[model samples]
Target: MTSHTVQIKLNGSPLSLETSKVAKQADGAVVVRFGGTMVLSTVVAARGPMEGRDFLPLTVEYREKAYAGGKIPGGFFKREGRPDEKETLTCRLIDRPIRPLFPKGFRNEIQVINLVISADNENDPDVLAMVGTSAALSLSGIPFEGPLGAVRVCMVDGKLVVNPTYAQQSTATLEIVMAATEDAVLMVEAGGKEIGEEQMLEALAFGHEQCKQLVRIQKELMTQAAKPRWAFDAKEGLDSGLLEKVRQIATPRVVEALAIHQKQARAEAIAAAFEATWAHLVTVDHVADDAATRVKTQEYFEKVEKTEVRRLIVDKGIRVDGRSVKEVRPIWSEIGYLPRAHGSALFTRGETQALVATTLGTKNDEQKIESFEGDIYRTFMLHYNFPPFSTGEVKRFGTAGRREIGHGALAHRAISAVLPSKEAFPYTIRVVSEILESNGSSSMATVCGASMSLMDAGVPLAAPVAGIAMGLVKEGDKVGILTDIMGTEDHYGDMDFKVAGTEKGITALQMDIKIGGVSVDIMRQALAQAREARIHVLGKMAEAIKAPKATLSEFAPRFVTIKIRPEKIREIIGPGGKVIRGIQEKTGAKIDVEDDGKVTVFSSSAEKAQQTIDIIQDICREAELDRIYLGKVKSIKEFGAFVEIMQGTEGLLHISQIAETRIRAVSDVLTEGDEVLVKVIEIDGNGKIRLSRKQALRDQPALSDKEKLKIVPASAAGA
Candidate 1:
């Protein structure tokens, strides 16, 4: 077997790329290793474009094998099932930046597969997956627009760290994944702790710098390991006469239809105009057949619409919704709409509507992520659901698709930055955003609704966050920036930039463009405009509920946290969890004990929570001298009676110390079923407790008038 390897030093670590040694039959394949993590990325394209294909059919899949982390798959199937959320998001991460790099009008069926074959449990392979996919595609014979690189940047302890390990990411205030060429950034996905725009820009620059090194490395590898170019005939464009005819017929009609503010009405008008033009073209004597005519006319009409939309935006600065370039749609928000939910909010922006609800739960409710990175518990989760009814369509219902996962992740990143620390808010939080209506920027609406709902649940967020989607239409030198863009602009525009942040700074931002790349200055301007719109949306949200509610809902569970010595964790848990289970059963509380000895108790009643805490405390607490306990009598004997003072603690009460006066027998004064107050008179060398009921009563202070009156019988008090 022939083997070729190239090694480079990146971020103080050695990265090795090997090809011609694995998956040799594939069109192009490479295995990349960083630290101890390894990923195999392979790319293949069909010999020629499929018939009737008008768009690039590209699919990217990222899978994690349980054995990569020295574990086994979980669930009834005991093997890998459908793609999880992380995997789905990773697929998007690989697809977004590379999708634009393919040649224009290239309709080949291309597939890229990334597999995590090995994991170090510290460094994640997702970033490496992107770089490897790029390398594989660069080596393929298919016509790709050259190679780019991806990198992960993190801000740790007031300093920027490139390619940080999982441990460092846990403490980093900012995390960003950037895809770029040597000069310009093509894609960015980031979440920050209210980081200012300048800082975010700096991070992007840092990431891009790292990407340059990787891009150079890829170039070197490509020089030695490139395949011969494939042969395929490019599809021909429409004839000039046909294009001119369609333009002349549809331009004026499309212009008038786009000016209508109502979505459904405008849609019908545009469809009617296109259908009329199509009918005219089909009736031409040169048209060969009905099916062929329909296809040609449909494609031509799309081109016409694209031309008209760009002209309207870049020349007239007019949007389909009739809003100005920078104007945001109308917004209305309300919280506490669901009485049973811990927090709930409904937010509507123009035509998009999101009903978001937040549910508070104990630690047991946290979502467990079992992956090659090891087990992780997610305490804050945001789920996005898009029903067919949201878009006024009739479609088959199924689980969350790739779009839902990606949108939910964006919203999660935007809101997670402002959430309070676990120590401040102990309840596990889950936010679900249901799209009731969608036209433009429903994901941004989800972000707004989630923020309002989180606050409604009394989650002391650092600041309220809002999101806005920005669009760009470029014609020649003139460029128009559309804020709060709708679905039509997103389809025909050059860029779809979604910016989310608080008033202080940005928390998250995701950008994907259909063009080659966007200039940095344009990105800066977009950020500034998005900030203004975000503040405006926040104002509307504040009117609904200015801040998080002062208190949690009455139905929500109350949580209390306490710290204990690590050594005592086992003692509290007992053998086979006997002691902890007993405490839960007795007090009706949910208990979560961490390895670090931080015990959190959750209960509907604050009183029960405190009671559970007391039980755990007694189990772990050391016996103290001179302290008294209301203990249970355990036995009757001639010499003394033994009393159970605390959980698993016993003290001997001698007959002589049973009461203030002499007693004939221990049974007369203290029976096994009776309760009595006893003082810890002494603790012996063996940790045994010595109790005295007489001394406990003797040391008790005399009751005052108020205390004495409380003991009066009801009949005597009334008389």
Candidate 2:
């Protein structure tokens, strides 16, 4: 057997990608083992691009079969078909970091696959897959500027740990998985127990420091097995000569043109300048101008719009909205914007607007998440919808595309930071954000609108969170950072780093660079600037509506829960849900029970919830007894007789303890319902009360002990 290995220090430990018997058919295959877990990754690129492709046709698939841990499929007719939630999330992790690393305009039909071969119970498959993909891509002759590496960092006891185990992640206050090149951060996804901003930044830095080593391993593998990368027919860049003309003509006038600030006024002035400047070239005398001149004239006009606008921002240091670099556009928000929605909010930031609606439901509404771990439940989910009309374009709205899923997921992560814990709000929450208008950062607008809609539904958020999109245009340290960037700035700028966060720290960040990679110093500066703008956005949100209030809508359910002993839980919820269903049917309420023996009752009305609570308590309540009762014999024995004392309770009356009248055969002494005043003597472990007809007479002191003893002895002798 031929064996090959590529080793590098990762997270301060020796890491290796060993190939011997894994994925033998692939163009380039390697088994990446991290800690105790392992993933087999293969990279294969087709001879050419899939015909009629626009963007780089890259496909990343991560699979976790049940047999990875030697387990079988659980349900009937077992087979794995759909990717689970973990698989979906892991696929995103791989796609995000590597998508940017591919050389721009390299539209090749490239596929990178990571299949979990084995999963040691303590290790994470996601982290290992990330490492394996980078290694495979590096060795596959793909024009990847990668060797990008990822690490999962979490805070355990306030100390950040590198590449934490699955167990450590559950209890950690922070869960951060970030990828980085040696020079700059490529991607980051973090959510947790409200980690501090400084700590999150520190975690990112630590993760990057650890990931550098894995990236080194990729470089070595590339040197060993890589083929010459494919070439792309590069297209000409923007015309500098024509752009210079427009910049010269429009740079000065932009200040006065944009001072009007309204979109209509500025667009008119820019349009008039374009028409008047090139009137003669397409005049009646030369209506059929040559193709080159016509094309050049059109290109000149396009440059005026793209460049002069940027030049206005760069040289004058002024924004098209007439604000300074650090300034944010105005914000306006309102809830109950739509009458039919269960809950709705209209969030407008500058020109971007989102009408968000929230709907809550019973367990039936829960989303079923299947992962490598198997089936799970997602009680809270957020979906975002963007119609072409949002951008004033006419198009069909139907199924969700990758862009929609990606955008929605970004917003989902941002507000997930402050969503009420399941313990506090048990309903399955679904939020849908409709992009009513778009100028820039529609996804960020979704984040703001979703928060407001949740509050409108009376969901108690940890705090109100807000998102702001920050852009940067840099050429050799002559950098301009635009806060709350608009559509035009985002198009012309080199970087669009969207940061969505709360006052505490960042919740979600997504950055796409038009230029290669931004410096770490710029990222830090962007982070700081994003933080300030986010705070202001949050403040404005609070102004419209503060944190979620205590009262839910009248149409919403009222929740009340009671904690009881775990053992008594079954009795409270009687046979086949007879007890619980009875309570709900009787009071028109809903109930959810937890394994910890907590019963939560929800109802449309408070009265209905209280009524259900009363019934549940009665079913589970213990009875108290003090007085004696007349009992009848249910069965006979040599020494005693079983008697019926209460509706559901039984008592025993011994033969010797019967009345002074001597009698033989217990049936002759007492029949069912013979009504004898019986005194309670003792209750046994099984809750059976012992009763004696003669004991009732002993309470009278006038009857001496000798008389009582004589009476009992006679009865015993007869028995």
Candidate 3:
């Protein structure tokens, strides 16, 4: 087939999508390009749905090759390993919006892969890959209900810019990636600097409008190069009779089980109900005990449970936990829970609890991230861990899963806006949140705990940040927006909208719509509710720790920042780093000297840190005239003696200047290795120093008779 291409102007640049010329064997493939960046997106599905599968098995992968950025892999293997955090996040970004658009009950296993073949460094490939995936799925005829579009929007210089360059993004106060259908928004991921709700709404609207144009272009591409859709039944094996029977037997029990307040109890009650229903079907109803039958029975039972849960919220105004729509759960927190930790907090909101700890380190501890753009160092890092025991489950523990990474990234973004600048707080900060118990909104709990831990550690954050997870249950005209939603609500609800920020505004937000999409009005209402919940959480957090601690913990490392001339960096480092190493060895401190003459010392003992700083300052100090120093005599000559003053500085003390009366030889008054008081009499243009011992003695005050009597004469002391 001949290639078909379509192009459109987006964010002051032309974006083009082409298909039919590459990866023809795949169900559908599209190569998308903007500026000099190009990404190839391909979608392939199994010939038929997997038997006994009740859900869509979809996988999305995004990879960037080192060659794309004109570089090679750095490791010994010289090849790419598993997906990094950015790639994993981009994969999620492409999957979240498209997964909801597939036909219901389409259990086919589908894989969507995006490869960044070329990168220009100016434009980001993630959004392009997203748009390409949509186009590929649209052309693949895989029963997808989308020609959706995605766009990145940022507020630069108080103006909303669509797909701003990386430089502009660095300075942007608000940045968001929004995905939407023609009628509504499907997904949103955003981070801001305490931007208000109104401004966020405006930015969302602006991004949505741009997405419509992208959607239009994808449609235009499909019209030119569309292929015949494959024939697949969405509800091939769905038994209506069995579904009704299961619903009749399970609905009442499901409702009763939902009334349980505790998560484990509710789960056990639901499981018992399901077992009883199955037993009744097998014995009384004489149903077959087959794998397909069992799978269908469980599927219908879950469907009934989902329906009842939604009805209880939307129709009856009763949530599973029996809370009102806008009510939050009970919140309690403790600071400094771990005495040995630099900073720690135990934050509990109802059933969800997090034990967060903050560790402070010097520049050596900063994380170095290698990406296509360049290597960058991060001084602040947040990690989230969700062990199986948090939910009372027994499972193998290993590396963090995609869910963990995504949740951690969201929480990291939320709290990062409030962290102090590196210059103000010159210590590397690491916040780790261990989920001790979870019922729902554990990630948001992490956000709250991270804030408290940072304050407890004396991080001097700009403001306290808090996060809340809101759920939406909508049926036609009736809609319910649940605040601080639990696990069941999140599972059965139409939207999971998380908002995090301070009392002033939002710092981060993430929304995923499981239904068709949500309107602007719904989004606005959800944001307002989330803001209220966030503020409530913040208030509870303030009860534990209102602001950063004035002093760090005794166990925490002390930091001292010293600035010197750029040229003095070499002096601090000394020859082959011997001087700096010696200072560190003597003081037991860590010193980091930057090219711009920024020196940071880290030590557990404040005295040691101060000693290290003094050493560095002396090494970088210049000799000042008339200043007196206890100089060490290096050598004695007939003409003069070389006296060492300050670190690494030598001054010439002439024989005549060594005594009040002229001396014939310098050794008479100043012998080698003698400690004598000396004054900096002159400093020449070339940094040579001249010292005077006579002037230093003459400047001293007259001694009292008693003090004079205490001084022993040299001849008598020798005898």
> Which one is best on TM-score?
3
Per-residue lDDT for 1-719 in model 2, tens only? 67678876544555678764567667667797766567898888877655445467888888887777777866886866666556767888888778878765566688888888787665677877888888777766667787878788888888888777767876877777877777777777776555555666777788878888777777877776666775654443334655565456554555456556766566677666666545544553344456655455555565556665677677889878888999998899988787656678899988789999988776656898644444568888888788998877789889766567778888888888788778878888999988988888899999999988988888888877788899987756578998999887887787878888888877777776655567667878888899999999988888778867566666777778898777767866678878677777889988877789888887888988898887777556443344556454566777777765543345778888776667676666655545455677887777667777776656644643554332322234335
The TM-score of predicted model 3 comes to 0.91
Clashes of each: 0, 2, 0
Point out where model 1 deviates above 4 Å: 237-244, 284-286, 562-574, 595-597, 614-630, 635-642, 652-672, 676-682, 690-719
Alpha carbon lDDT at 579, candidate 2: 67
lDDT of 1 by residue, 1-719 (tens): 77777878766889888888899878889999999999999999987676676679999999988788888887898998888888899999999999988876777899999999999988889999999999999888788875888889999999888888888898999999988988678888999989888888888888888898888888888888889877654445546677778888778888888778888888889999987887766676354447755676667778888888888788888777778899999998889899999999999999999999999999999999886656789999999999999988899789989999999999999999999988889889999999999998989999999999999999999889899999998877899999999988999998999989999998889988777777878888888888899999999999998888889999899989999999889878889999889888988899999999999999999999999998888878887899977777777789998887877678899888876679888866555656677889999998888898777766775522233321233244346
Residue 71 lDDT in candidate 3: 90
Overall lDDT per candidate, in order of appearance:
0.86, 0.74, 0.90
Summarize candidate 3's per-residue lDDT along 373-392 as a digit string, tens digits: 67889998999999999999
- Candidate 3 or 1, higher lDDT: 3
Candidate 2 TM-score versus the reference: 0.78
> Cα RMSD (Å) per model?
4.5, 8.0, 3.9
Number of the top lDDT candidate: 3
TM-score for each prediction? 0.90, 0.78, 0.91
